[model samples]
Target: MIGLGELVNSEGEFGVDDYRACLAAKHANLERAIQEEWERPAPDQISLTALKRRRLKVKDEIVRLRTGKAIGRRLAAPA
Candidate 1:
């Protein structure tokens, strides 16, 4: 499992926008994997669930980085 620390550098080597873009790409790849798994004749529920969870985490991080909010903090409900 890839952690935020792995994608980010503590030495200030990379910027926040770069991390956001990486997370976005990772999220998109996870979505594609989920879709492909769904299309399989024998879909693996365990793998699909794991992928979805990771995707959610990446998405949460992306939102936090973009809006300067805490990670995993729920967004306001849309009207």
Candidate 2:
């Protein structure tokens, strides 16, 4: 699976700066989900496009969190 950076970079509609900025904002939103316990999100409350965007945001967050954990492990190892 493509990572969040790759996915955001692949967006043709946005320039690199805007894409990165948007992804950063989405990342923050996903982090908030972690704090909020995302289970109760109202599925029927949002438009289809918004729902799809949220799904992708969560997927990207998963990729980001896993990558961060791996990096942390590597950094923690004795050099």
Candidate 3:
């Protein structure tokens, strides 16, 4: 299964800048969706929760990529 973290360019290569840009666009769309949902008189909890979860996942991937770390890898911070 392809994951967002495994995104590739049209040339079939992973470009950090391109990936970041894509993530940014996705994040923006998610934010807009969340805002729209909130604007509704009767917001749906399920939809809001799903959107927020997806947004958070995208954010985490952006952070991980920016830090030059592979997705799903955890490194202990110095105490």
Candidate 4:
């Protein structure tokens, strides 16, 4: 897990934008991994699910950092 504090510096050398870009690279890598797994002759469902979850986490982190807010889930209306 990438900790926000680890990436940041006391001198402010790493700004939010830089951190976001780093996360962007990670996001792209995860996307490629997911696609590659999907393209296999027999994709591993477990592996795919894990990769997807990790990718989503990275995406959510990126959004939170960019917007200064956590992404909220929209609950379905009562039937």
What Cα-based lDDT does every candidate model obtain?
Answer: 0.75, 0.49, 0.78, 0.75
Q: Residue-wise lDDT of candidate 3 within 1-79, one digit each (tens)?
A: 2344456544456656656777788999999999999999999999999999999999998998988786554432223
Model 3 TM-score (2 dp): 0.73
Task: Name every residue pair that clashes in candidate 1.
Answer: none
CA lDDT, candidate 1, residue 9: 59
lDDT of 4: 0.75
The candidate that achieves the highest lDDT relative to the unseen native structure = 3
Candidate 3 off by > 4 Å:
1-10, 71-79
For candidate 2, the TM-score is: 0.33
TM-scores for every candidate against the unseen true structure: 0.70, 0.33, 0.73, 0.70
Sort the candidates on TM-score, descending order: 3, 1, 4, 2
Clashing pairs in 3: none
Model 4 spans > 4 angstroms off: 1-13, 70-79
Error of 1 at 40 (Å): 0.2
- Report the lDDT tens digits of candidate 4 across residue range 1-79: 3545555566535566657777888889899999999999999999999999999998999988868663344322223
Candidate 3 accuracy as lDDT: 0.78
Report the C-alpha lDDT of model 2 over 39-72, residue by residue, as the tens digit. Answer: 5565343444465577587567556655654342
